[model samples]
Target: MILSCIKRVSCGRIRPVLTRFLRASTAKHHDLESYLQFLQTQANVATESTYYKGLLYEYTVQHALKKLIGISPLTRCGGTGDNGIDLMGSWNIQKAKKKLDSLTILVQCKASKTKTGARLFREMEGVHSYHVSKSRQEGRTLLIVAAPSAITKQGFAQFQTTDVPILYCQINRVQPIYDTKQDTFRIDNFEHYSVVQGLLANHAAQALLEKCDLSTAKINVLMKGNSVEHKKASPPVVQKITLT
Candidate 1:
């Protein structure tokens, strides 16, 4: 009947919204120190710069990437650049594939206190459309989303549907970061989408390989889904494990 059809149509639209709300609400979002709070206490810095917080978080995440995933020589391209890619680096795909291979990685970091929405993902899609996803002659390209606060359930769903392999790095802190310098409060925690966890299962099993997940961004991945948690290494403990 027409009534039943109307109900179905409405349900279809409402379900996703409801789901996103419920899931995002379930995620444990801690009280984070805002940029205003950080700038007010600081002596001299561009308080008008809205990107200050975002850029600071980028630097912090970049350092974490270096230690965890070995993203060396990372290029910082933030601010007015239309490209959604904030940081660029080389990622090793050896573990994902048999032979050794590297891909150019584009990273976009979203450190908003609340869950990131689909708008960010849309921008990422614009940066590298299906064309890049298909592996170009110049070289393969991989997109990495670095969200310290984590992405919303609805936004994550969009990522899941993408054919392109996206390395979703959920980098966060238990306490509010007050320091202006990226060095002060070291980020020790990270979370992953289910698909990322599955792809890095073997590596996760190995205490040595598990902690660093950013280096495996590759194509033809099944995108099979776990939440892989990682902690930063201590000063002395870090000297032992050799990166491959």
Candidate 2:
């Protein structure tokens, strides 16, 4: 009986160590996967930045289009491939009764890093003129120039004078890079986390109106089951979207 008791005690002592070893192994694998995913995302963004640098002119134009009203390459433009504007995308805005209305935009990407001058503005105006001449009313036409570097204040002022809105994406202002060590992202000087979270919020509100997935943040808020319906239906989707 004494031997039996000793054996049971030994087994009990060994169980926790064995269980801890298994848990440590599982945790190590999970951490490694998370780290690898972070690295992959950073690498992809960096490669894109390098490629943009190589084609400095085109990058500026694309950047301008994206910054203005959050139009991305992924958005549907619903336009033709005429004139200088090559890409298109759209964003859904929220309205009363939580409805989503999409605004489509046409982009003209110009790869020109040269210093800004009257001639550059004229060239952009000419592109806009040509775009209008194509007789397409699918979406608003935007003349964009992606410069290799920055545009002078004088050049920006020149664009401001006209009813014709010319979008200029300066190279330095919109440099997107992902740093793995910092676990952070940036577009030029702008941080990614705040911007991403804002987008997620907007997306959530729009989607819920469209009967899509509720914003994760919103779900969390609702899950808490707080009865503070104080601010109408502002929906926490926007905040959740920003965190992404």
Cα lDDT tens digits for candidate 1, 1-244: 0111011111122111111111111122211123224435567876335455665566655655554555555645454422455665665544552332555556777767677666776776666663243333122455667765545667756655654555656554223334457534323332112111112211211221233233233221211111122223221211111111
lDDT score at residue 151, model 1, on the 0-100 scale:
54
Cα lDDT for residue 83, candidate 1 = 43
> Which candidate number maximizes lDDT?
1
lDDT of 1: 0.43
Model 2: worst 10 consecutive residues (lDDT sum): 1-10
lDDT of 2 by residue, 1-244 (tens): 0111011111122111111111112222222223234445444544355333433323334443344334454211112323344444443444344422543333444334456555666665665555443343212333444443444556555555544444443333334465668765433333221222121212212333244233435433542333243333232232321000
lDDT of each: 0.43, 0.36
Error of 2 at 177 (Å): 6.6
Stretches of candidate 2 off by over 4 Å are 1-68, 73-82, 95-103, 108-113, 134-139, 148-150, 171-244
